[model samples]
Target: MDLAPFKHVLLLPRVRPLALLMFFARMPPAATGVILTLHVAVTLDKGYGAAGLVGAAGTIGMGLGAPLMGKLIDERGLRAMLAVSVTASATFWLSAPLMGYWVLLVCSFLVGLLGVPMMSIGRQVITALVPESRRRVALSVDSISVELSFMGGPALGVFVATKFSTSAALLFIGVSTLVAGLLLYWANPPMIHEDEVVDGPRPKIIEWMRGRIVGVLVVCVGATVCLAGMEVSAIASLEHIGKQSWLGVVFFAMCAASIAGGLVYGGVKKAPSVLVLLVVMAAFEIPVGLGDGSVLWLCLLIIPMNITCAPLIAASGEHISRLAPPTARGLAIGLQGSAFTVGNAIGAPIAGVAIDHGGAPAGFAIVGVIGLLVAGVAWLLARQRKPVATQTTMAS
Candidate 1:
């Protein structure tokens, strides 16, 4: 029997109501970093340290909020959590312009706390609603949309800030978030409520945490750390070369590469295993260390590095979905999101300090080393499987 026919049945339309909702919802948060930085620079009359604090606060909020929101989705329903989060995000965005540095920090933090969970919930919903065979394609589409938003949000934020005013950028992000949230609420996708189903009661959170699911999360955290390190190092290297102007070009190229990767991933017959994907992704880091500081070389290197990112992320998502129990899927995915947020927050500062002291090449080397370490760990995890006897017992 050809597995291709089985996989074809799983492919769903790329543009669905839920995907549209997530794209818009992610825009504000995606754009916020650039706008918030500019706003702090222009309005707060503060130093880089202060701005860094504000940025850190938002990342921390995202890390804290995502898992909580996932738990909420599990306990209540998608609709209720979506409504609450949207209202919270709208309020934060509208009030952002009026706030001082401290207040802005708090507002941005809360906004991140509320904003990021929607993506996790949306992923959970899609996993439940979409057929198993088509899920990889569907998730690849979602991953591409996320990469596009990440690329566009910062650029748009910078443009609006330069053309109009910082406040104008904030206003745009605020309104976009509100609209996105409301649309998700109205569409009201089917909920995957594990609480309602009576099957020997739901597993306790602690119990659920004790298994392969946690192992998967550990690998996810490692991959995210590598990703965050590379992103920070790449930007720092560009700036050090006195080609800060090329930052956008480099980022655009990387994102474009990821988009291509995602598209290709959607059409694949047998997706690579998570371990294999991580190994491939680690290879992307070699270019970061190998490329000379030339903008052209850097840009060229980014293409291969980015080509692996989306597929790795999509594979990670697939692993998480399959391992997590139905009721805990939201929380599990939320935790996975939190891992990435935390990794980025930690990686950026370390890369910045390394660049300041050691030079840009040092930063890239650091990231490359981290990626290699993570890849090794992933390989180890792949090899150390539970015995077949245990699998048989679990199945029984």
Candidate 2:
């Protein structure tokens, strides 16, 4: 396997530290919801439904706030945005243990609304730091880091909550959030590439937000929809087979597949377009439904499907960086975050309903179809635009 791509990205100054910072930075946010849900259900005695409401509120707020925060980063700058978000996040998690359920709900929304823009910033900085030719590998590494953070963060949160207390878990998140924020503030990686001119007249939203860009965003949503739906279906399938205890094992396998995929994607000289990767991912997920009623079968089936996961994510980031102008790149990446939020929000419900009606197989099949449908929409949007040489280049 060619290690050239990884070496090139790591050789660049600032990329290595930024990657490490982002991995730590992502952990607190990753664990927040699960910790909060466990807190509400176990500690507060509110039950799972109420706990879900709190999680939903936080998710909604994050979805609504992502673009606004991105726009702020565009208008103001990174430090200014980080200052406010860090303070809000710190205050919420620290005080959350004291608040009643209702107050906690409101505070959670506020925190999410002003949450730290870690993910978007990482993408922006990575694009700025790496040349376009090396961006695929850079972002692939970043995507793999994200997979690792999500994997460990929640498990750590659960460990603390179970071994100690939910309040301790909340406090842990608070301290980590503060540390991540301050470290980022001190580092202050360049938000815009030096070569890009920000002083020039900015393009109107209409100019850059339509056609291929919209298609990329659609593919982003479809990608997450497949992921979230597969997760729900996998859990349900495990429960159906009384193998629910294998949840961690299955998820670990899935994450491993994604990491392996990302490593290969980064090493390769060329790759399929965002839409093509999304279609391929969705296509693979459908067959996973056929493995229903067996945990081992489901785990094996999801591996090939998940191999496209990180590649799709990295490809989307590469395209967005190429397509959007420097002036609005933050907002474009933020919209990508929002698209992910939208996909996760709806995907679970779609899968849950399908599972309720038709079992785990239907859950997987239905979400896979939803992904394909959205990919088709993306293809149509891209096709509507007159073919451009730049579009072809950006897709790679």
Candidate 3:
């Protein structure tokens, strides 16, 4: 099949709103690490452990808050939810450093909980606004924006923190978030309108959680765990080796690879089945784990490993959009994003502990094993359902 047809699918006519939403959604990831780093520096007398605990609190808060925000968006319109979330996030972030440790923890939690749903909302909006055939590519682009945010956010955070202070950095993050949200509100992107009256009350969470859709969510959780573990391990390893500065280079390589992979995947007319893609992506870790190579070799391995991240996310988004009821799409994406946030929260600590005691290779090996297991889960999920005739049809 000529893949040229698929290339056009990646280009949406009204992409401005999506781009704007993504810019706002990415601010937290960009700023959170720097905030934490600076918070630790300022509070070292309080204990490094406290900083870690606060960071964990923020992540947990995000994980818990996302689903609730999703439900609200389902009931209310995007504007209301965005306004509430953005305002809350901005207020918490701006005021965070002024508070005591316990209060900071609370504010961080509130910020994270309120801060995260914007990205999920953006994803839901894209699914609703974009045509089915082009949704995968669009989602891939969205994922790329997320990766870019991570790549760029920390650097920005560092600069802000260095130039001013941790409090200033936090303020900057808060302002950026508010600006993004306001821009999105003014833009008023098109969304699927809900009816005033429902046939019945909404389905129970358990009812919504049933079937292949849950499987996709599980895969997302697993993939996020692996990614987080890998990221934590890589950072720790580089630090241990006294090559901490190379961490940025390594991430840049990985992100560059992901961008190329996303473009390639978006262009493929006959992309592999989700199961196959999962397997192929998981296999990329083997090279990473087997080599004890230099930074360049590690960078090389990152490209293939990074390439799969976006496509895997795009696949999950496709599945969630296809399986969820129209009214519940927001909640569905929220649940998926929540799973990812939880996985990230869990992964970093686990990997950090593993690297501290067992060493870097052990940490990477652990992540690799997790990826393999997730691949197996993907295969089982694929087997449970009949394969669709085409990837595009599966997405629809």
Candidate 4:
């Protein structure tokens, strides 16, 4: 695959620095995913259900709060939203080690609610900084960067907690998150200027949430649901096979496959639609159940299973950027973010319950079936989602 597009994207003004920030900024959350599950399961001696609940709490908050903060960014700009949310996130991360179970759960929800809108902001800035011609490649880089972050985040979280202590790991994440927040605040990223909104009628928020844009989000949510299922199931499969140590490698390889797919997608002249990518992703997920008995086998399966991840993410970001009205840019992106959050919020716990009851095979099947069903829904929606402009013009 060609590396030129990635190189061209990085050289853009204002993009390289934010890309750098993305490296550190995405790590802590990635780490938290691994660390929190380990901390609750290994340290606190909780079950997967409990761990899933905690995980879901954070995602639920993410789902609920992303749009609110996104709107804040739209109305007030990036500075205040970044400052307030990052501070809240830092406080919660730092205090997590000391809190009890219920408190930690509540805190998880609140932290996610208050979590910095980094993904939304980064995409918005990328939309603002790059021209339309380069937007897809830029978002492809963004998605690949996200995969790279997950490569380190969870493994580091698990490693630190294992070598030192969960408390130490939490402290590290807390400090690192604090620094990231500060740096982002200092960076003061740009927002959508929405110059056209100055003279036009204000479009209602629901208008943005329906039709083609929302169809993109449906694909996003479904894809993420598959991802969360794979994650939890992988964790269960590794533990089942007594090769739990290889968990990090499996996640890395899968993410690496996603990166590879994204790079290829970026370089291509013609790409598939988001719904088509989602269908491909769901199709790959079905065989995951067959690999449940062995970690090595599971890793082999994930190469195909993850081939669509980054490409889907890149496409969704591009469409959201292309679709939303200027004034509602933040909210639109925020809604997309929330869809993934909602997927994650529900995905793990459902998979965990499946794993708890019927083991890894069951979890895999559940994810695959749901993914296929959801992809079908997204595809049907996409077909029907003609832009209202064309229909309205035709009608008039």
Candidate 5:
């Protein structure tokens, strides 16, 4: 609806390139996700269960690796993280196509373990470059760009795999990772460190988690959980209704709504709180789950649920930027990634079991109820937040 948010952030000299770099960097994860499952199930003749385990290994690795990478970035800066991640990632991805099932399991874990820190790095750069007042816009731009990769990468992965070859898809992921690595290396976005405290005890990372930061992190996790659950349920529903082929179109529509919502969020002078947005997101999806099993009904119901997606993420990003101490921003941002990854890991499988027991509606109900519960707690935590950090920062 509005172009100012896009114009404001993109016009920045430093931000423009980093945004482009992130677009490329984000592709590998999405591409590999589809390719890995397809490779294991179709090409290697392994079943879905085995494919799920292989995928889980990578997800678990990422959940653990993101925060660790963030801590290192806080100490060493972005360049060092980029160097290690790019090399490790390139090696792991290139080798992925060659490994047998057992070896592939090991490599997936290692691949996730050494996953490129593009997301953490990109968020840290945004935090450092944008002032607090303008952070909402910056965050929205970042969220929107991420959604583009989120939507396109998997489609591309499936296309290459189906149309050509699985090996070609794997090769594409590896080559793309290599290119993304080089782009990041050249961008080398500078980190801004806080002024040193001469005599006072330095702030601890745990200290930053004292208030709204905790809420931000939890709300983000919950939002992602909903996404993962919704995805699993949608696919399962399609299969049940015998229209599974429409899966790509369904997901693509949702992604488009998210991008549109993100654009509006950035344009608005003030956006709703993360908890409120989550409530809306959770509430809307229930109807989708209860839909009369048809593609048309599913698409109609998903509109409201998809609308809130990127706006909620943008709010969480802005909240963490405000909540964390300037010095530990990278760690804070990284932890956010870790939280989302954990949600990503748990949501689908849990929903899968639910889908099996009572069909897609059951999974949808489970995830929606979970969202409502988490949003309630997030609201409580947010309300309890002391203005201590803002006051202290202002006084200084």
Candidate 6:
């Protein structure tokens, strides 16, 4: 395997720190939902269903707020957005533990609406800092950091909640959020490339927002639909087989496969199209339902599908950066964040219904089929893309 691609990207100024920043930045948000669930279910003595409602409120807020925050970044700049978001986050998390259920639910939505725009910032910074040629590798590294954070963050949140207290967990998240925000503010990474021109007129939405960009965004949603559904189906499968204890091991294997896949994809000279990767990922997911009810078999079946995960995400980021005008990249990235949020909101419930009616196998098949259908829609939309017009700034 070629190590040169990885080395080249990391050696670029600012790329390594940005990657590390994103990893640490992602951890607190990754654990926020799980921490909230534990707080409601365990501390408040509420049922899991009630906890889920609060979580859903937060998700809805994120989906709506991401684009607004992105627009803010576009208008005012990164530091301005960060200051407001950091303040909102600190206030929310600090006061969250003391609130009653209704107050927490309402405040959760408000807090989510103002949550730090880390994910969007990470991608935008990559596009600005890394040249078009190195984006695949850079984005692959970013995706790996994301996977690592998700892998450790929720587990740590659970451990703290279980061992210490949910209040302690919430406080921990609060402190971490403040620190991450301050670091990001101080670092103050560029949102546009030094070679790129931004003082010119911003393009109207119609000029830059084309069918191809929409298609890429659609694929983003579809990819997450499959991923989130797969996770739910996996848990349901383990529970059905009375092997719930193996979940941590199974998830670790899946994440490791994703990281490995990302590393390989990044090192390659060329990467596949986002649509193509998503199709392959969805194809792999369908067979996971057919595993022979053993940990080894499940892990084996899961690996191939997950291998496409990071590559697909990296491809999506690469495509968005290429297609979107630099001036509008923040908003575009924000929409991408919203797409993933919408997918997460949709995926698990669909899988849950399938699991309830037809068991774990049906959950896998249903989500897999849906993912394929969505990918097909994205392909059709992409095919409708018009020829590019001449411009001062060339989009990828």
Give per-residue lDDT, candidate 6, residue 143: 90
Per-residue lDDT of candidate 3, residues 63-102 (tens digit): 8888888888778867888888888978877776677788
Error of 1 at 91 (Å): 0.9
Residue-wise lDDT of candidate 4 within 1-396, one digit each (tens)? 677977888898889988879777888877887688877877778876798789878888888888999898878878888878988888887888888888988899898898886777777877776776787898888888888888878778878898999888988888988898788778877665433333567567656556577678888889888999988899898898788889878887898899999999888877777877877887888778788877778989888869899998988888877677767788888998998887776677788898899999788778878888887777666666555322211000
Could you give the candidate ranking by lDDT, starting with the highest? 2, 6, 4, 5, 3, 1
lDDT of 5 by residue, 120-237 (tens): 7767777667666677888888888888988878888889999998878988898899998887778777665233222445468656676567777778878888899999999988
Model 6, residue 319: distance off in Å is 0.7
**Candidate 2 lDDT for residue 88:** 91
The 10-residue segment of model 4 with minimum total lDDT is 387-396
Count of backbone clashes, every candidate in sequence: 3, 0, 1, 0, 0, 0
Instruction: Provide the TM-score for each candidate, comma-separated.
Output: 0.89, 0.97, 0.89, 0.90, 0.93, 0.96
Residues 38-133 of candidate 2 have per-residue lDDT tens digits of 999989999999999999999888988888888888888888889889999998888888989999988888887898977888888899898877
Pitting candidate 1 against candidate 6, the one with the higher lDDT is 6
Can you tell me which runs of candidate 6 are displaced by over 4 Å?
387-396
lDDT of each: 0.70, 0.88, 0.71, 0.80, 0.79, 0.86
Which regions of candidate 3 are displaced past 4 Å? 1-13, 43-47, 193-204, 290-293, 381-396
TM-score of 3: 0.89
Best candidate, lDDT:
2
The candidate, 4 or 6, that scores higher on lDDT is 6
In model 1, residue pairs whose N, Cα or C atoms come closer than 3 Å (at least 3 residues apart or on different chains), thus clashing, are 10-133, 10-134, 11-134
RMSD of 5: 2.9
